[model samples]
Target: MKAKPLRRLFIGFLLMAVVSTLSVATPAHCGKCNIHLLTGSEYFYALRDAIDGAKHSIFLAIYLFKTDNHPTNRATGILNALLKAAKRGVETTVIMERSDDPESFINVENEKTGRRLLRAGARVYWDRPDRKLHIKAVVIDHHLIFLGSHNLTHSAMKYNQEMSLMLNDDRIASEIINKISRFPKTPFKRQP
Candidate 1:
């Protein structure tokens, strides 16, 4: 009788240890998160690839949507990918930040980028001025989400050591999509 009781206690302790070890191995809810780290040009490649491969829609929100276009430049490759994605019937929507002083370089360059996107059939919106819209994210088809510190600028593309996290989870993606849908839109001017 004593041996039987001791064996049961040992087994119970072992089970609890195993359970605790597994649970504490990583942060909570990490099983479903599937986050992948993206750094530097890897960010650009994955973003461009996702836009290129998108079947239904692409949603982009950025602090600065500035890029230089040249045939030999990889930055232009990203811009062209967005345009081509829209041309292929992908419902592409972009939300960018706008300041009250439109003459600011950040605002001016962003507007120029917006017009190019507009001409290519991408719907562009400036966030409401009550708050600064600085979120940088891209959601594709309600399945993939990319969020990071990167601004779509020449420096970000060429020099800065930027970081982004790519998540592929439908539940999280749906939540993000629903939240983004509520952002108030501001007027965008078309360039002549």
Candidate 2:
């Protein structure tokens, strides 16, 4: 499949992930929330699912949200999912690494990506540029959370091996949200 079409299909899948939220869930035993151990593509898919299904908010604290022009195009792919959720009035916000890797193209493209997200109506925050915020986390609708080592990059999505947890727990999610609220915020600068 061509990269552009694959990208479009990923967009469709993201829309379905949100619109068909029921598919992402199963009956929980006696009110115990569901949790899944996501690895590889499952990890990224689950993140997309949660963001798509979000009714209230999506908060992301990512280490790197880099994009590439490869055929896989995992970089720009995920941004569509994020912007879709934001367009749906999901209150999407991203807190990206402040001190980006000096030698990383991912870091450079991420600033550009942030600009795209801003145009898409999402709030993008850069964590204190003085310090490195090496976290990859997402909180959706105050209940679901994804945390792990996956960067929002093509390698992390399709090529590299990565691990993350998909959880449906409001207690811990709330606590994390409160903690994120205290993190020093750095404004995103639009690339000229």
Candidate 3:
């Protein structure tokens, strides 16, 4: 009788251990989605590839997209990719931060980059001055989402310790896209 009770106790302990291990190993979310944590320059490469591979549509709402279009610029590739995507018939739409002060660094750079994108057939919008749209997000093909701290700037992409998540969840992507679409489109003049 003693042996039987000891065996049961040992099995119970083993079961609890296994359960704990499995729980730790499993993803916290219940959704069947693939999540990749992108850190530092990894985000740039991933985003470049994602943009390059975009087929139907690409929606980008960014806080800062500063670029000089220089050959050696790290962020130039991403800018080129967006322009290329638009040229290739992909519907690319960009919503950038519009500062209250037009001559602000963010405003100037975003306008410059936005003009380039606009000329390439991409629809560009500036957020209202009163409301700041500091979203750093990209949705590709209504299926893939890149959301986090990584901005389309050289420092953030190449140097800053930025972190972002690439989620391959259609439901979440759809929700994000809807939200992005609803962002107030305030018109602003593009500098020549």
The candidates, ranked best first by lDDT, are: 3, 1, 2
Output the worst ten-in-a-row residue range by lDDT, candidate 1. 26-35
Clash pairs, candidate 1, are none
Q: In model 3, what lDDT does residue 104 have?
A: 88
For model 2 the TM-score comes to 0.76
Score residue 138 of candidate 2 by CA lDDT: 89
Weakest lDDT window of 10 consecutive positions for candidate 2: 22-31
Candidate 1 residue spans exceeding 4 A from truth: 1-33, 190-192
For candidate 2, write residues 62-84 as lDDT tens digits. Answer: 88898755555765667878889
Q: What's the TM-score of every candidate structure?
A: 0.79, 0.76, 0.82
What C-alpha lDDT values do all the predictions have?
0.82, 0.79, 0.88
TM-score ranking, best first? 3, 1, 2
Tell me the tens digit of each residue's lDDT in model 1 across 20-104: 9988993354356678898888888888898899999998888887777566556567778999999999999888888777687
lDDT of 1: 0.82
* Candidate 3 per-residue lDDT over residues 1-192, each given as its tens digit: 899999999999999999999999954552888899999889989999999999999989998998985786767889999999999999998999987887889899899888889899998899987888889999999888999998898889888988999988887888888888887886545843
| Candidate 1 residue-wise lDDT at 152 | 81
TM-score of 3: 0.82
Q: Against the true structure, what is every candidate's RMSD?
A: 10.1, 14.8, 9.3
